[model samples]
Target: MGLVIIFLLVALLAIFGLVRSIKDKNLLGAFFAFGSLAVFGWFAIMTIIYNGFPVAH
Candidate 1:
């Protein structure tokens, strides 16, 4: 529950960052936004794998 909420918040922030980056036409900002989003996705995947896929088990 808490994880879901946190992820949701991060997602919103990431989207905001992405939009800002796009509007500013900043390559660095866009890179950061993508990197942050990738890290979040990595964490989520790791959590699922560690917890047994939440489906296989």
Candidate 2:
């Protein structure tokens, strides 16, 4: 639902941050970004799998 969408957006931003951090050689930023990506991405995927797209009210 709405939560899944928010998680996906955050995960997408994390991907961008990961790329930027790698390009800038910022290890700490990259680490945090990667962690964010993993957590948010996992949540988004699991939510979709468990609840189905568009979800049921």
Candidate 3:
């Protein structure tokens, strides 16, 4: 539950950064925003696979 909430918050922040970058026409800011989002997405996927779909005998 807590993880989900944190993830949502991070996602929102990333979106906000992306919007601001776009409005400011700053490529570096946009890159950072997207890179952070991709990293977060990868972390979420890895966590889900490790916990939600564990392999056991």
Candidate 4:
């Protein structure tokens, strides 16, 4: 539950960062935004692969 919320927040922030970077025409900021999003995706995928979500009760 907690980790899910954390990831959600991170994902949202990354999306916002990407949008802001693009709007500002900042290439470096865009690169960092993509990196952050990629790391969040990695964590999400690993968690799902190991736990299979909701722990099967």
Candidate 5:
């Protein structure tokens, strides 16, 4: 439960970072933001696929 909530919040932040970088037109910032987003996104996808949401004890 907590992990899911935290993961969602982090995901939101990553998206926000990406958007802000784009708005500022900073290529380096955008690249790093996207890289960070990709890392988290991969973990999210893996968790969803293997453990599933709401995670079992």
Candidate 6:
């Protein structure tokens, strides 16, 4: 759960970076940000689906 939260937070930051990079016309930065967003977002979603939030003890 904690890992999921951290992943989600990083994904959110990646989203922000993606937007900023696009506005600045920085292709490389946008690419990296997009990659980060995909990886982190996927991990967070998968974790939630597999383990369930507040995971049972």
Off by over 4 Å in 3: 45-57
Each candidate structure's TM-score, on Cα atoms with residue i matched to residue i, is 0.59, 0.93, 0.63, 0.71, 0.75, 0.90
Predicted candidate 3 versus true structure: per-residue lDDT over 1-57, tens digit per residue: 357546656867888998999899999999999888777767766676666743446
Model 6 residue 56 CA deviation (Å) reads 11
Residue pairs clashing, model 3? none
Candidate 2: residue 13 Cα off by (Å):
0.3
| lDDT tens digits, residue span 1-57, model 5 | 566557667777888999999999998988988887787777777777786678457
User: If the candidates were sorted by their lDDT against the true structure, best first, what order would they fall in?
Assistant: 2, 6, 4, 5, 3, 1
Expressed as tens digits, the lDDT of each residue in 1-57 for candidate 1 is 357446646866877898899899988998898787777766765665676444322
| Inter-residue clash pairs, candidate 4 | none
What local distance difference test score does each model get? Answer: 0.72, 0.96, 0.76, 0.81, 0.79, 0.95
Tens-digit per-residue lDDT, 1-57, candidate 6 = 787899999999999999999999999999999999999999999988888886557
Give the range where candidate 4 is weakest over 10 consecutive residues by summed lDDT. Answer: 48-57
TM-score of 1: 0.59
Model 5 per-residue lDDT at 54 = 83
- Of candidates 6 and 1, the better by lDDT: 6
Q: By the lDDT metric, which is better: model 5 or model 6?
A: 6
Error of 1 at 25 (Å): 0.8
Best by lDDT: 2
Write model 2 residue lDDT over 2-43, tens digit each, in one string: 889999999999999999999999999999999999999999
- RMSD (CA, angstroms), candidate 4: 2.6
